[model samples]
Target: MRMLHHGQASAQVDLAWFFRVAPAKRGAPVLVVCGSLLVSHTAKPPARKETKLTAGHRVAPRKVAGDLLVSGKAYANPAEYGHSRAVRVAVELGKWRKELAVFGDRVWLPGLTGSSPSEPLPFTTIPITYDRAFGGERFAWNPEGMGTGPGERGVRLPNIEYVERRITSPSSMPGPAGFGPIDPQWRPRADMRGSYDAKWLAQNWPGMPDDMDPGYWNEAPRDQQFLDGFRGDEAITIRNMHAVHKNFEMRLPGLTCRAFVKKTDGQLIELSMMLDTVAVDMEAEHTELVWRGATAAATPKLRDMEFLFTMLEPAGALTPPTGCYAIFEALRRKTYPTPEEYADDTKQAAKVRAAKAAEQQAATDKVVAEALTYRDTQMAQARARLSSYKHPSVPANAETGRHFSGIAGTIGPGIPEFGADIQAEMAQNWKMFAELFPSDDENCTWTRERVMKTHADGGDMSGANLSGLDLSALDLTGAKLAGANLSGVNFTDTWLQKAALSKANLSDTICKNTLFSSAVMEHAIFKKAVLTGAHFNRTQISGADFSELDLTGLNFEQCAGAQVNFSSAMLKHANFRNCVLPNADFYKAKVAGILFDDAVLNKASFNDAIGPGASFIRASAENLRARGADFRNAKFTEITALRCNVSQSQFDGADFSRAILTRANFSECKLKRSNFDRASLESADLSEAVLLEATATNVKFLRASFEWADLTGTDMSGSNLHEAGFFRTALKETKFVGCILTGTTLAL
Candidate 1:
């Protein structure tokens, strides 16, 4: 009585009513119901068989499996009894569970699934908490069994035990009747449970191919319309529900669909996706894809519903539902971030920009310093050259004429504003030269007293017309008469020392016994002027024109007269000792007895000048042109005439002892009794020249030419005649002892 009768049924139920309804057959309802029942239990129904259930009520096979998994009951199936529901639910669960067990204890491989070898373990563990599964039930916590011992690396793990315990519902309520017994030892084992290892999942899940369409999910027309019309404030968030198992998320906020997949080892692996405005969740293996502008009201359909959703593999395996492939594609190109790591990256970029800015500033500062130094150095050099001018003393035997009687310590007018007065005076002077000033008679009524008054009042009187003026015996020392018209003027015994007469017109002027020492007479015109016994010592007469002038006995010693013109001038007995006359023109001038000792006449033109007994002792005359000049008995002792042209000159009894006359031309010249002892005459030309009784001891005649030349009674001892040419020349009584005649071309 206590145990046998299971008990009278508490409620009488219609078994067929709980089952799926079947469509009525054409003949009767009995056969239709029988056929529907058979179709439900069988694996395949006949292809031509008519089912009582219409398409609307029918469920797909995989969909039934999913529903069973979610609800733990196959309500959509034809099975009505409790035993059938339980058996169907258990079977579907076991099937899925068995597929996921392959990755239970497997480790992940690197590069194959975007998992790096440096990443920690894929499986994680947590303490089995009662709140998660057992609702405040006391339980033993074996920390060593839960991976808390020395065998485990400290990492956050998924609550695997709690999930399994909750999902399995292993124990039923304990009652008097032993319907189901509670067993603590009957726990889920690794062989029977599903595994969701994060690394394993990430390694097995499929990703977008390199050639797939990137805009499949994001750029469709319907998706664009939905996105464009959306205006929501609540941020849309997504999460990978089974990312630890399949490397995939089930629900993505902005995308239409997502999926999870089982690996060969039965582990769920996560896969990548692409979507617009997607932000990655970098906290763990399983995380959500967050975005903006998504609505939760209606289910989002795929942008392109016509194309079947599929996950494609390299081997062409198609996993269905590929609508949200853009999201995974975009994620593949992205780098995940946590808030703290992002902040660190931003700080690092700021530091790098600051460093570059500092470097550029340092470079700019260096350039500015260098520029300032260069400017300061150049200013110092200019100041030195400007202050080199020395003021001359007034001589006693001179005129007492006064015009600001003290010597000027500096050059030029002091007040720059007074330059206008000088310009106006020049204008009047020019008008006077054009026969327009002072009633067109070319007359200047300015007096020395008036000029002195003007000078005292700081008025400039430069470039004034003082021509034909009787300025003799006047003490005009250190006066600023620069650019003045002093043509035909008389300056006998004038104390005009240290005067600035630069660019002045002194043509036909009488300057006998005048003291012009330490003066700046640059570019002064002395054409046809008489300068007999005039003193020009230590003067700056550069670019002066002394052409056709009577400059006899004119002493220009120690003067700087570069680029001066002495062409066609009468310079007999002129002493230019220690003069610097670079680029000076002495063409066709009568310069007999002119002394140029220690002078620098570089690049000077002395072409066709008549100068007998001209002394160039210890002088530098590089690149000088003295063509057709008559320089008989010229003293060239220790002179340097490099590349000089003294062709067609009379050099009888002239001495070139210890001279450096390399590349000099003595062509068609008379060189009788000339001494060339210790001279360097490399590449010299002596063609059609006379060299009777000449001494050439220790001379270097390398590449020298003596074609058609007379060399009677010449002593050529200790000479180097390498590459010398002597075609058809007279060499009577000529000595060639100790001479190096290599490559010499002499007439046989």
Candidate 2:
């Protein structure tokens, strides 16, 4: 069918010939052919033309009986047409009889075979059918005109033919009258296209054209084929028909997809449409296309179709050919199987899922059962082992007493007595026994008689509580008085040689001229004690506390300990030669003329200590923290004081030759006339320090900071002062002869 513009000739019809073949009954079958004819601009003229004599001599044509030829004109410019070329025509042949019934049931036609004045011929009666004809039906038309029988004269009816023509009239065809502009405020009852589905379409537009179906339209090409189908004047007409159906016939399925009772109800309807099933109102939305146990599985396939529709709509896949809907529906059913097939597959899937779940549960149960069985077996074995076990028997009190008596009897004095000389030899055994096991009730109140007895009884007065006692001029040689509480006691001129006085508490005690040589005084508490002229040579005073005491002229030669705390004590002229005093704390202690020669004072803290003229020759005082200490005229020859912090201290006339003072912090210190010859002071901080007349010859002052320091009259000859800072320093008469001063920051 050729589509034509609006108001153009859509079809050709012969009323006279239609009346002859149609049945003579109301509602009788009558075919009305509605053809869509496209009028081309280059159409040829008609093949034949009727003479004027043949049209004028005929009796005045009655409007009711003759053929009503409705023709339309086409413009040269198709744009001026402003409508689709597809047209549809409808004629009610039954209605014609009702209108012309007043003129009798039958209409007569006069014969025009010959012109004879003498003999007048009779008019023939033409039977008119009272049949109803609907448009959109196929009908066959005879091309040959009505013929006359032999010896019977009759006028030949004109034959209707399909023709294409172009009209030159500038005036275009106006729309049918009595139609006004649609209301601008009109809106659709529902968002049909947005929430489009088969049920929605069926409810909102039951008579929707099969071509405009979503299943068909969504798959149609948006190219030339879509343009040709829904183009021109007919587009609005077909669109109007769709709108009328949506507005009047179809029910609103709400605006959102969630409005449906079942979430996938809309999807199922759409899928049914794609499967070529006629859509009807379902009892329950989900009941029409039952997936059995496969609704979830089938939803994705349905969504695929929805996705395809979404991709097509924006691309002008609106109107498509009628047969394409069928083709697409067929293809969709092939790709996604039917709902019955889907339900069958879902049933099988459900069985498989059930079987897997059951298998997993069975495995878990088996594991639990085995664990319980193993636990029972282990409990049984434990019970059997416990039942067969035996316990050792304990001896009775009488039996133990008898066995000890028999052992004593074997060592009893039942043999012949020894001579005087032999007995003298055995007397030494009593002395040995007394040393091994002293009297437990000695009271430790040392009278001269008790002291004589203690000396005679191996001098084992250990754990003696002799507080506030005077043991002056007492000789405790080779005594085992360990762990004794000798606090506030006097030991003037006492000799404690080779004594095991370890862990003795001698706090606040006076030991003037006391000799503690070869004594194991480990962990002894000697805090606040006066030890003037006391000798600690070769004493094991490890972990001893000698803080806040006057230990002037005291000797600690060869004294060894883990550490000794002499903090806040007086150590004037005291000797610490060859001492092993690691981690010693001498905070605020007076060490004037104190000797620390060859001492291992590693990690010693002498903060705020006054040690003027103190000697530290060859001492290993690594990591010493002696801040604000006075060490004037002190000797530090060959000391390893690495990373020592002696800042803000007095070091005037102090000798530090061959000392390793790397990374030392001597900031704001007084070093007048101090000698640091051959010292390693790399990365030392001497900021704001005074070094008048100090000699630092051949020193490694690499990366040292001397900012705001006074080095007046100081000698730094042959020093490696690389990367050293001397900002705003007083360098009057300062010597840097033969020094490596590379990268040094100096004041201009």
Per-candidate TM-scores read 0.40, 0.41
lDDT of 2 by residue, 290-395 (tens): 0000111221112222312100111123324333344444444455657987787788889999999999999999999999999999999999999999764565
Name the Cα RMSD for model 1: 41.3
- Overall lDDT per candidate, in order of appearance: 0.55, 0.54
Q: Point out the worst 10-residue segment of candidate 1 by lDDT.
A: 1-10
Any runs in candidate 2 off by more than 4 Å, and if so which?
A: 1-446, 746-748
lDDT (C-alpha) at residue 216 in model 2: 24
Backbone collision count in every prediction?
30, 14
Q: After superposition, how far is residue 74 of candidate 2 from its true place, in Å?
A: 58
